[model samples]
Target chain A: MSTLGLIFRELRHHKANAALVVLALAGTVALLVAVRILATAAERETRRVTRDLGFNLRILPRDVDPDQFLADGHSDKTLPADAVTRLAAAAGTFVSFNHLTPSLERRIQLGGRDAILDGLGPSVVGPGEKKQPMGFNIPSGKAYIGHALAQRLDARPGATIDVKGKALAVERVLVESGTDDDIRLYTSLADAQSILGLPGRISEIRAIDCLCMTGEQDALAQLRNALERSLPEARVLQIRAIADARARQRQTAEKYTAFAVPLVLIVGAAWVGILAALNVRERRPEIGLWRALGNGSVRIASLVLGRAVILGVAGAAMGYFVGTQLALQAGPRIFPVTAAGIVADPSLAWWALLIAPGFAAVASFLPAMLAVAHDPAETLRAD
Target chain B: MVSCDHLVRTFAARAGTVAALDDVSFRVERGEFVAIHGASGSGKSTLLLTLGGMLRPTSGAVSIDGRDLYSLSAGARTRFRASTIGFVFQLFHLVPYLDVRQNILAGVPRPDADARARVDRLIEELGLGPRAESLPSTLSAGERQRVALARALAKQPPLILADEPTGNLDPVNAGVVFRRLADYQRAGGTVLVVTHGNDAAPYATRTLRLDHGRLAARLTTEVL
Candidate 1:
């Protein structure tokens, strides 16, 4: 009989034992694969969530003192009306810039108290536009009154507010934006610019760099540098904290995977090692029988090690397949927004496929060596 | 032919090291059936294993066909045993998953075109033809022994070793096993067997008795 035939028949004789080892190894691999997919999906979702929060860069006319800008929360500094248009031509796919020019504040009697109003004008940032500048844009002659101003004026949507002798309908009472938005009146950009007597100009340029850090480049930092260079006459304030949050979250996920991947494999190896050791002990008589049948130590060792390798390969493949399905099912359930479908991460898949079997081989190595150490005379003589 | 010169084997016990074979020496020529009788722990099984080079002697040497058995490496000794020796045990030691035919076929170092025919003839001659396809677990004690004997003869080795080949068998089966060993000796094959009972003495051309790991010098006798 061929050696392969003998090995195969031996497996059949102890099918249950072989199956037990494979099952344990497969479970370990499956868990690792699932976690890998989860980590990838979470990192991707972090980026998207970070992007949707809003732009971290503000471009206002240069040479404005930070103290003055903070005290008034208004700037007479203006960027060219065609600045965005001109920049668009030179911008790569990464740029997402927009324009907004708040009207000069006006005083009028509202609920017996002097209230100030400003119009969102020049070119209103639209709702459907990709380069969104904060809230949705209002139509011509329409206004979004701040929550505090509306309370003070005893006004709501569809009410008229006259400022600087121009009457504009209140389109909607703005929710308390908690920042400068609570006390401001917003109108179309063109109306704001016209009312401020600045034709074809803007107070500030609001833009999202669409800047994501990746293998291509440190796009976020690069975007900041590009903006400072191209619009040197404009003050570029880089938004922080949120971008830092995204980066930190991504780092945490990577670290967790780094620690977890090895932990799972070590556990897998341990479980398989225990099983292999026990199997070797149980098969001592058979090993002695083979030795007495004139098989050498190397051949005897091969009988045990060969089976371990085969089981390792088989278990790895099965675990990878099962893990993919589990990740797909569990990910969506755990985090509906972030956990996407199966990520075809070739490296992770390769790692799972390669390492699982390698662990099995290592797990079985001691037992295989021990199998060879048995003296055929002593083992058979015991009977 | 096989020769041993003052062979000694010791194993470490929990108390201390104890010798299993003490200055034992013997030789067996071709075409001889030699039976060894001893009480349990008298080292009859150890003697068989040492002669086959499965166990290394603590002292002295064993030579087969003029080549020092222990002088060869482990791998070479294994190959030598496979090519030159066959073994039968009391428990049959047939692989539980294999059928009788496969068990018999396993003894050959490598099967050739005539291997199947040889195996078939052995099974038929041993009256195991009807049960050849049956697994070892399903065979009767007598049937199992016959399969083991056939396996030993499958490779056509010049020397055969049997350790208590009939220890677990009934008298009828024991007689049959001895007869098979006798037949191989008559056909110019060397056979060395160890049995607890004297029933196998009639089948051997010579008998040697061991006591306390030492051969009883004056007890060696030629069977008449």
Candidate 2:
């Protein structure tokens, strides 16, 4: 028989053995794909979450006394009349900023119970701030309320709420966002300042800018720097850094997969080896005959390994398809806010296809080599 | 032409080192059909394996067409065997899964036009054309041996080695196996047949008998 033909036949004979190897490799590749998808999904979700929360950077006073700021907890700070314009102008030098605060407090009865009132607003920066229109466009006197607060207060869109004893219109009921500041209400900067009776005072400012760092370090550093520069003494606080949190979650997921992938591979290799070795042992006489007729070590190795590769490829392909279904199911459950509300990562499942074949080849190495190493003469003499 | 000079083969089993062949010397020229007759455990099979280069003799020189088999590197020896020799066993060690045609083609160097043609011709000559696609398990003893013979001749090797080519066949089928061997000889191919069957004596150009791992007697065609 031809070398390749012989190899094909050998593999065909040991189909089950080869299949086992392929299955193992497919599992490894699937694991790799899953971890990859989870990681990418986590990243995508973080970005979406950040956008939904309405801010990237929180700007506060750099030189204010920390003791005094904390003493006025949750209360409006009375800065100089020009303090908001000055801080806005300085921040405008480097980046865009939007300042916001609770405008009016609403006391409403819902289900015969009193409801808590909170407010949100867009911050005001200098006219030099890029994208000035979007930063300034907050429907004045209109407000958005949290779903929980709305439910408790029986609040509806366009309904009026008693904010600090003044009637204010509720524009929309906010979705339940999973962030630290989700329970509060939101309104325009001008309206919040007027109703809170703290004119020229701003609680927080949001900045939309990009930074270049990867993982937790980048995120923590960016938050620390923005808060330190904008509100050094004011004690800059962040609602949450989604990217860093997701990164941590992905890291934890990958760590477990890393441990599991190799364990599966090891077990798979062993199982394939045992099966192949037994096959070779059983075929010793035939192998001896072929060797005596003139086949070489390489030919014999091919005969054994070729069978394994075929099986490996089949199993891997099956596993990849299964993994794709799994990813589809997982995407929606994990992050339901993307374009399709499902992960569309281009690099998601493609790498797995290539890795499956290599896994099969690797799994067959020892058995194929061992088969060729047996002495033809000794085997023929074994009776 | 193939010749063995001062060949010594020993096996180191768990008990002790046992000598299978000791200082055995012999020679056979091209186109000669020689019979090596020996009783069981008389090293007839060991001689065949040694000549096939499957076993490394303890001390010896085996020369095929003036090239010492042992002196060649392992890879070179393998190539030499592929191009120069064909072997057949008494049990007809056909791969059970492959059909008759594939079993015959197994001896040929892959994809060689001349080898392919040679196999085709042998299959036709041995009357296996109709059974070419039949597995060995379904073939009769004589037909299986014919397939084995076709395989040996397929490579057009200079030397043919047969170890009891008809040992498993009845007298009638044994004669059929011998006829194929005789036809091979007529085609100018040198062959060595190792067997205890005295019935094979008539077909050999010369017969050498072995006793106790030593050459005992040589009888020519005229004597037979």
Candidate 3:
């Protein structure tokens, strides 16, 4: 009879033992798969939540006065509008900053009242990145009037307003915010440059730092170094509060996964090893009989390790299905923002199939060796 | 033919070292039926295992059909033992999961149509036809011994070594087992049986008595 035939018959006779092994393997695989999928979803959710916190890095012209820029909430000194293009074209610029938007902000008189006129240019992202542009994109002939400014100027949606002898249609009225934005009027960069009589100039380039580092890591130093190499004429200023929060959230997620994966593997291996040892103990006489019947060590070891491989394959298939289903069901409740992006990952199935069997075999290695090294004469002569 | 030259086997006990076989020497020609009789702890089983190449003697040597059994590599020795000898134990160490047919087939070194046919004939000759497909757990003690004997003879090796083959059976089952071994001898196969009682005396052509790991006496069947 074939060795496989014997194994199948033995497994059928010892149904409870086989079932327990398969269940242990399945539970380990399930936990790993769930953790992997959920970790990805958590990262996506964090990126979305933090992205909404707004740009935290402002790049101003090197000669700008810090006190004047802070008090006025706008820079008097300006750089060429093409400075945003030069920085975007620099090597490794996106590695330190993203969502590069050029803006020119100034205080001007509108309808006899002082208001902030903010000119927003198109955003340039990293190569091959499909991220949505942050903030508003205003057309050259249109304006987005804030609540206080719209009330003071009697401007509503679809109403044309006069600014510096230029007529611009009001596209939409922004909602009331408690910040200075409530008295600001948004326009295209070309419109602001034309109206201010200073063409091809922008006050600052706005961006968010890409270094997800805590305050202790000196993230500002790294940002400044990267800026110095790429755009020496401009200096970078980072908002500590927002950057620190994003770093802490990302690190916490990573630490959770690092702690979880190994714990599952160790427990899984121990469970498999113990059960395999028990199986070898139960089949002592059978092993002796085979040895006496002229079977070699390879054949004997195959009987034990082959069973583990078979069970591992079964467990991998079952675990992948169950874990994917679990993630699909419970993911949206945990991260509702990117819940729709959660879907079954086919590559996980391939990885599970490749690794689980090898893991089981390694776990059962000592037991298989014990079976091979067993002395047949001991059992046969004792009988 | 089998020959043992000053065979010595020892064990390590808590008290000290003890010898299981002390300078034992013997020989059996081809087609001879020999029985070794000894009391419990007399080392009859140890001597049988040593001769079967399952246990290596502490000193001296054993040669089967002129091949040095211990000098061969472990793998080659195992393959030689598979093709040359058959073994039967007292406990009927049949695989619990396999049925009688599979247990008998397990003995064939390289099973083919001839081996399968021989196994079928042995099953019928030993009166195990009705229980051929039954697992060892459901069989009676006598029937299990019959299956074990059939397994030993299934390969039709030149030599058969039985260690208390009827130790667990009744008088009637013991007689059945001896008669089968005698039949194999009549067909020109060498046979060696080790037992505590004289149950195998009637069928053995020669009997050797062992006392305290030493050969006490040797007698022919007619001398008994």
For TM-score, the strongest prediction is 3
Looking at model 3, residue A376 earns an lDDT score of: 84
Q: What is the TM-score of chain B in candidate 2?
A: 0.94
Candidate 3 docking classification: medium
RMSD of each: 6.0, 6.7, 3.0
Off by over 4 Å in 3: A70-74, A109-115, A138-179, A182-184, A212-225, B222-224
Which candidate, 1 or 2, would have the higher lDDT against the true structure?
1
Distance from true location, Cα of B20 in model 3, Å:
3.1
* Pairs of colliding residues, candidate 1: A56-A239, A120-A187, A120-A188, A120-A189, A121-A188, A121-A189, A121-A190, A122-A189, A122-A190
Report the lDDT tens digits of candidate 2 across residue range B1-224: 98999889988889998878888899999999999888877888888888988888899889999999999998899899999998888878888768888999888877477777777888888889999999888999888988888888888888998888888889988887787888878899898988876767888888988776678778775675
List the candidates' TM-scores in order: 0.78, 0.76, 0.90
lDDT of 3 by residue, A27-122 (tens): 888888988999899998988888888888999999999999989988899999999999999999999999999999999998787899999999
Ten-residue segment with the worst summed lDDT in candidate 3 chain A?
Answer: A208-217
- Candidate topping lDDT: 3
Better of 2 and 3 by DockQ: 3
- Deviation in angstroms for A283 in model 3? 1.2
Docking level for model 2: acceptable
Every candidate's fraction of true contacts kept comes to 0.58, 0.39, 0.56
For candidate 1, lDDT tens digit of each residue in A1-383?
A: 66667667877888988888889888888888788888777766665566556545566778667787667665657777666545544444234343332334433455666554554434333335553345446788888888888887777888887755667798899788676566677777677666667777776665544444444455456655766656667666656666556556666777888899788878888889888888888888778888888888878888887777778777888888888788888887766666544455557567766776677878899998989998877566623
- What are the per-residue Cα lDDT tens digits for candidate 2 across A171-234? 8887776542344556666666676666656554445333334453555455566545654544
Can you list the residue pairs that collide in candidate 3? none
